[model samples]
Target: MAQNPERRAALVDAAIDVLAREGARGLTFRAVDTQAGVPTGTASNYFANREDLLDQAGRRVYTRLAPDPASVAHALETPPSRELVRHFMHDIVRRVTADRTGYLALLELRLEATRRPDLRRTLTARLQPEYEESIRFHLAAGLPGDRSTVSVLYFAMLGLIVEHLTVPEVIAADPIEALIDAIVDRVVPRE
Candidate 1:
């Protein structure tokens, strides 16, 4: 409802932190305002309701977690190959790990979505296109994968990220990079 972009962005970002730290049940407008260090009701001013805040937080997490353009360009500069796929996978792990809060907030949003149909639809709409694009990019870039390969790799990496972030002890046996290499090797054929 507020027209100030900076304040709105700050509120959304604060909402993300609140979600990650307190889960959906604790994500109140007051919590976000306190997290943002703004006056009380500031978040409510920016967001029409809890649902609006949740939706914006979901979108903000993705925006925060998206790869930098420079990295994308660097990846594209290298010839498409299994090694490149490995590089991409490694980057994914690194980025998510580096932004643990964002990923955790995203996980929280995912759980909340189960109870909110509108959120489920919003997340599905946002994520499905990216999933499809991964497949398209793998094919168009001539990466060593088909749709199934990309799908499996996507799922495997997602599982690994969840484990690494939520219950790291489960994967403490091996270095994450080593595990990433194994996943890429198994899914993407050698050139």
Candidate 2:
């Protein structure tokens, strides 16, 4: 079907709002239409099914959350070191916290993906290249450790992001950037 990119993008953004606010069970075409303030059936017309809507929403969230190219390039210019990793980690925490709703929507997509094989496949495919890029960046930067270090750092940051976003009280004692720096210090290995 011919799709209006602007309308489709709006509906997908509306879907993100619905996912973040209502959770996966509440993410329906009607909810997205309502969130977008469009007439009923608008979302359904744009998205063939829930899976397609979710896939688009997930991609949108990634696009919104990914680091800026200029910032990444600047960081890449510096040699990879513990300080560099900490800087990037701090940037990530700031970005996620700044766009908490988007990240939460992504978390909702992750949960939805667990139950839906199609979504799981799509999300996994979407993330594979990012993971590869991180590995390449680490190697190129000459960071210590290996892919396993990258994996550990990824999951640990993810856990921190989840906790920091959901239950601020759980980590309220430590400053977020400090906590991120500490985590990066422990995981990235010394130069």
Candidate 3:
């Protein structure tokens, strides 16, 4: 069945907004329907259950986590790839810092799913795509590691952000920036 592109995009945007605002706890069929300004039945028609919606939303958010290939290309279209790097860095910081609430919810989702191996399997199914995207992005910038490096970095970033949010004393000052810089230094060679 074909989908309406505009509506699909709106649903995705709504999913991000809902996730960012309320976390996984707040993601329900009716809630997303309201967020998208569509009818509850409409959401149901698109998603069979809460898990389906959340999982799909998770995928959407994961895909859009950073400066995508198109944006990277456009940013580098001019004289300086510096603009592209800056744009990418700016995007990364913004996305990571802005969606703490959602990230926490995702963490909770994982935790809850731990009791049900089937659910855990369903939720963790997202890890591969997320891992692949990071690996591809790092590789695009000439990083020398495989998917494992990207997975490790991705998990570490989330862990650091949570720690920084929950226990500032345990976290070093300028942690996010430091991590970003370290990642950049590895992925993008310094002049």
Candidate 4:
């Protein structure tokens, strides 16, 4: 495998784009190289096989989608209230929607994971900590909800996002921000 970190990261990013555009079955070293604008076999040198490429793409998507540290810190500065929770949820939707390709790549990873047990385990392992941390943050920040609230909000936002991204016309009449506010209103208790 190549030792150049920047080049490797670029390949993984390109792989993510390929996965989003082509799905798992269409991901290939040649396709990745073409996407990355690198010479043929460049991706092969960085990744051992298709699985390795897919795994790296999955990891990269999370990295790309993670909330900005500055934004998180700023959110923390505000008193944790139902309104704050709404803001955070809105931020999540905004971030995901802004990075459409990354989210799409993540969706591809989820679909691919369904067919591969190893991938399912890998994705579960990767996401479990983040999920737990969200719960912890909600409690620690004095947000007006418990684990169950956060869990429901997570699923609800995920469904909303999937619909907004994949078939937006289905929900075209409803504003996404309003839907998010409604979800937070229902899930988190008022002060």
Best candidate, lDDT-wise?
1
**Residue-wise C-alpha lDDT for candidate 1, range 39-72, written one tens digit per residue:** 9988887888999999999999999998898988
Q: Sum up the clashes in candidate 4.
A: 0
Q: What local lDDT does model 3 show for residue 76?
A: 54
User: Residue 171 deviation, candidate 2, in Å?
Assistant: 0.8
| C-alpha TM-scores of all predictions | 0.97, 0.94, 0.60, 0.97
Question: In candidate 4, residue 139 scores what lDDT?
Answer: 89
Tell me how candidate 3 scores on lDDT: 0.63
lDDT of each: 0.93, 0.88, 0.63, 0.91
lDDT of 3 by residue, 143-179 (tens): 4445665566566556666675556577576666676
Please give the distance, in angstroms, between residue 93's alpha carbon in candidate 2 and its true position after superposition.
Answer: 1.0
In candidate 2, position 121 carries an lDDT of 95
What ranking of all candidate models by lDDT puts the best one first? 1, 4, 2, 3
For model 4, the run of ten residues with the poorest summed lDDT: 1-10
lDDT of 4 by residue, 1-43 (tens): 3378999999999999998899999999999999999999999
